[model samples]
Target: MSAKFHWVLMVVFVCGCHAGAASIAESFTSYKLVPNIVTKAPANVISVKFPSGAVVDLGNELSKPQVALTPSVSWNAGDGLYTVIMFDPDAPSPSNPFISSFLHWLVINVQKDGIASGDTIAEYLHPYPPPFGDIHRYVFLVYQQRERLPVKDFIAYSTIGRFKFSPQDFADNFNLGDPVAGNFFRTQFNSLKTDKLF
Candidate 1:
């Protein structure tokens, strides 16, 4: 083979490798679960562990798993209070989401690398996508807070049926700025009973 031809092949091989890696990373960044309201990328990635010791990935597809309690989360936020949000942006159905971004969980004033405690504003609501509905994206977003803010009213606001909630608006209103870390998982109704909840 000619030296010039070999060089071209090597270049193509390297570019292909890079493209594969980029596509994997883009999967998380391009996730439509996170409303265009908040920044797409975060400063860091947070690790979330289910009760069954399963660590959640960016777009892990889970069946109706038994997520009775809140998943444990850890992040490197240094010495600052942080806010955690878990919501399903594809409520009811993705095509016509009248109740978009249904808030599932909210914890505030969390310390670095810690699980939510008494500071939980809204309680965790396990994912329960309706049968035959589109897969729902359960997003977990973390934000560094400026200070401890009153969230009781905000928690109440989430309970109202068909209430509109925007993570971007919440961050802006509380001056939380961009998210520090985030991750999500996808779930849908399990008619076959193939997967077990953690």
Candidate 2:
């Protein structure tokens, strides 16, 4: 990929796979962000964008049929990339209230700014989901950055304050306990950095 255009990642994972049951009828499997999700790309600037149409209503949270806005953004930063993350805080969880879970909906990276709408040239990212799980809510968020941010792992910090993680910190945390954390952490941390678009 040229510096002007690089591939971003979009990912999805579910829970039912481990539960040993088919996905819930109305549960959210995954979500996708398309070019149409954004308003428009700049002319002189080659930029990547993501789906910002997601809306979270505690009343009626997101499900499989109800797609959340997938986050897409520029990767090289020169052309500009956007990253988005969408999740359900109230997703149907087990008895544990604090032990919140996350479902990855959009872990995609757009190649260029002018990719035609409905074009599937983009890529999809699949994190870990109980081997064959299904029907899980993933929060989709988008972050815009100036370059491709590389990380080693994913670290779960409830807030940004506990410890402002650099890309490296994130990479390590994700993989520390969950063998599946490194790959997912790398992608998720990259998205978080792009969020500092100013």
Best by TM-score: 1
TM-score of model 1 vs. true structure:
0.78
lDDT string, candidate 1, 1-198, tens digits: 999999999999999867754543465558754346465556466788888666777888865664545788887678878888888878777777778878888888887767645387677887888876688887788898888777664667447722466777777888988887877788887766544532
Q: TM-scores across all candidates? A: 0.78, 0.28
In candidate 1, what residue range of length 10 has the lowest lDDT sum? 32-41
Query: What lDDT does candidate 2 reach at residue 165?
Result: 20
lDDT of 2 by residue, 123-171 (tens): 3323222213233333332334344433211123223312222222222
Backbone clashes for every candidate come to 2, 44
Which ranges of candidate 1 are over 4 A from the true structure? 1-25, 33-37, 193-198
